[model samples]
Target: MHRARLARWVAGSVLLAAIGWLVSIAEAQEGAAAKAPAAGAKGEAAGRRARAGQLPPYYREVVSEEQRQKIYAIQAEYNSQIAELEAKVAQLRKERDAKIEAVLTPEQKKQIEDLRAAAKTKRQPRRQAKGNAPAAAPAPSKPAPATPKP
Candidate 1:
């Protein structure tokens, strides 16, 4: 009777251990599946990833063809409106510049030109002149020499 009881206890323990092992394996799989989607989650999570430059501009990973066409159409409409507005703005700026130029003296115009040259140093990077190599960064300015005090 004692041997029988001992065998039953061992069997129960093994059953419990097997169940625990199965539960752990199931939890591990669930964690892995959850991790992947969480890392590449859609909507704002995807947008933030793109903004951080971690992913490409288009983050609609599994978009259907119908949805893609609709997105393209919407983008086209916005782009057209943007181009129209930009052209109007450019025309208005040209008119404004002409009006301002009409008011300024030659000396003031020279000063404005100097200011514009200075502003250009703040710089949008220019494309490379020829080869595949990236354009060099602007040279560092030399520090002004200090005048010796008498």
Candidate 2:
């Protein structure tokens, strides 16, 4: 009779242990499910911010291997394009300045220098006002003055 009672107690303890494990598993699954939507929402917000030109928090750290390769490729392309454009612009400016030098007399060169200085002065206020103004406006038509009778 004591052996039988011992066997029943062991069986009951095993059953209770199994039940506790299952309850713990169920609770973990429930907690994970509850947290899933919050994680998804945060991911979506980060994506939106990145699209709007704001860097995600992860961007503050060292980039991953894949991202580093991508950045290197992009930098190489930009550098190539910038070097090409700078060469072209420098050539164009050289040509323009040479032409201007050839065309101007000494007096005209002095006048051109004065004009350039005046234009630089005038440009500052215009540049400051440019952001607030419309880019262009319609031209006004002028009425012809009265013509004398033939």
Candidate closest to the true structure, highest lDDT: 2
Candidate 2 per-residue lDDT, tens place, 38-142, comes to 777767544543443323466738687677545544444344345655575577557757765877799999998899977765555566577744444323445
After superposition of all CA atoms, the RMSD between model 1 and the true structure is 28.2
lDDT of each: 0.59, 0.60
Query: 63-129 in candidate 1: lDDT tens per residue?
Result: 7666655565445434434555557557755775686598789999999999887666544233344
TM-score of 2: 0.32
Q: Name the regions of candidate 1 deviating beyond 4 angstroms.
A: 1-59, 118-140, 144-150
> Candidate 1: lDDT of 142?
63
The TM-score values for the models, in the order shown, are: 0.41, 0.32
